[model samples]
Target: MGDYEIALGASTFIKQAIDLRPDVGIVCGSGLGDIVDLVEDKQVLKYTDIPGFPVCTVSGHGGCFVFGRMGGKNVCVMKGRFHPYEGYSYREVARPIRVMKLLGVKTLIVTNVAGGVDLSFKIGDIMIIEDHVDFASMVGRNPLMGPNDERFGIRFPSMTGAYDKELRAVAHQCADEMGLGDVVRDGVYFYLAGPVYETPATSRILRGLGCGTVSMSTTAEVITARHLGLRVLGLSLVVDLAPVGQADDAVGPTHEEVLSVANSRSLVVAKLIEAVLRRITV
Candidate 1:
């Protein structure tokens, strides 16, 4: 729940976001910031300019906010995401969602660059997150740890439909229509605390748990968005093919590789999102 301070802080982004009257909010993770550039008539605001917004301190993240029209609907975009590995509290990591809610955002589109733990996944692939294992929430570091805020959501909300089926359908339809189906996947995302890439053993453990993709940021934001009653749509760009079982089974991932993959594939990723948004009624 947003207390006075949190809610007040939201006012800053809200003041600017209101004019746009955004119904959709997009949080771009890692190499996905390019979507902000594709936004029509976009207005860019640096994270430093937004009061109470956490800064993104990683490579490949743009650390700003972009507002614009997409598919005839006003949208707000977080050009970069916050991470606990960057020393941000869970609440801080989720603040952007609260601000979006205050601004009347109804649907959240979250994108991340993930390592593919599922053996069948490959680099440059896009995985639509059908479900997730939120380590942060399981370990009690959830952004919603404090007292519940009814204004944001109920104390115990059902996640059965947290990620809207219609939105997922829209994404699938978009991918098929664009001939991007070959690179698209649907699976579960796993969240872990990471400044370092996971070890092969860890990858095996996650794979055994049925994780298709692994990310450090999106789940917290997803939980926040759901808590605020926003419909969620998550996608992970498979930048690295993780070593799931073998000892050093896969090639070690470098930030450079992740960046290159994301940079090169962003055009397609952007297209998928754009096409989906053009069809999303909410």
Candidate 2:
């Protein structure tokens, strides 16, 4: 089936569960599922139940979508998200974003747990994504690499300032209000095709390339969101620091460890999101 048709099918299925049209959408990352607890009057729908949505396979990843409210604003939260490392293509990973757009979502607030690539970052720090280097897509593995779907977007959607600057500023202002200024930082993030953690040398290389954080997801969905005319903002929780300068004996990150750290900071992530939602205009 065509991608547009697939996204329309999923959006139709979600509409069956709740009529609350969300202006803002959130894709919860890793063990950040606990943030769903902050959503009020939520209607939970499993990914499998949706006609074309991809089910998450990784452990600690929830396989559902939630329609709820925070700051009295309608919001749709994907309690979990698909990833390439889980055997899905980039298209599958980006489908939920398309579906959310079709469902009337105009803004996207994406969150994920990433390994710190920039030594300046500390574990539990939340990095605001000012830019991204889609290493996988840069090699032409992009999800948007296909026949043009004028219904979704033009064949060439400019990637300049793909992440909304105004929304990002609002995010930092919220963090400052919450006394998290020191813990919240801004930087460029890079994507890698991974189930494997980055090697210490790789971390150093990525840092040299100007990446503050690294992950296996987010960039694909952000591309899709921006292509569809949705304003986007990304937040990454640093679960662990990459061994950029540590000795050979230093430990590295693992999926289990990332999820554990995500659990410990779910509330902090949710508070920031809620604050952004409350202040975002249109």
Candidate 3:
């Protein structure tokens, strides 16, 4: 079956079950699945239960979809997301996003736990994605690399300002109101294909490239969302620090550390998201 048909199948099942047209879509990152708990009148569907969906194997990811209302807006939340490092192709990694588009999501809010490349970043800091460097896409591993499906989008979708400026402004305002102005900032997110954490040398290269944060996910999904004409807002929780200093013996980041930090700060991230959602105009 075609990509559109596959996405349609999943979205159709969701629609029939929830019977609600969501205006917003949310993808919760690692250790951040609790964000879905903020949703009211929730109806959940497991990934395994949804046809044409790839189940997430990561520990922190909940592997389900929660449909409900948040910030006075109807929304669909993905408790977990797929990744290329998980042995899924880019197309499969992007399926859930296309499903979001089919479900009538006009705006998408994506969140991820990332290693902070910028020295100024603290473990619990929130980085609003101003831009991104998709290393995977640059190397021909993009979600939209295959045959163009006109039904989903044009052959060439402009990614200029893919992270919506208006939505970002709303996020900043919400942050300020929550007194999180100091820790909340915007920066470039560098996307790398990773099942393994970065090496000291890799971290140095990312720093030289002007990346503020680095992670394995988000970019591909954002690309697919943009292709489907969805406005996007990306948030990165700095769960671990990238390797710094010239010392070769300096320890790098680890998954356990990332999850530990994410777990501690998940509530703050959830609150900020809720604030942003409340002010969003559909």
lDDT (CA) per prediction:
0.84, 0.89, 0.91
Between which residue pairs do clashes occur in model 1? none
Q: Could you give candidate 1's per-residue lDDT for residues 1-282 as a string of tens digits?
A: 345367567656557554676889998878877787678988777888777677778988898878889767789998888899999998888888888787778999999998999999988889999999987688798888878877778888777767788889889999999998888989999988888888899888998899999878888888888888889999999999886556644557888888888998887888789899889887
Cα lDDT tens digits for candidate 3, 35-142: 987899998899999999998999899999999988888999999999999999999999999999999999999999999999899989999998999867888899
**How many clashes (backbone N, Cα, C below 3 Å) per candidate?**
0, 0, 0
Higher-scoring candidate on TM-score, 1 or 2: 2
**What TM-score does prediction 3 earn?**
0.98
Error of 2 at 184 (Å): 0.4
What's the C-alpha lDDT at position 35 in model 2?
76
Candidate numbers sorted by TM-score from highest down: 3, 2, 1
TM for every model, in the order presented, reads 0.94, 0.97, 0.98
Poorly placed runs, candidate 1 (over 4 Å): 1-4, 13-18, 244-250
Residue pairs with colliding backbones in model 2 are none
- What's the candidate order when arranged by decreasing lDDT? 3, 2, 1
Best of the two (1, 2) by lDDT: 2
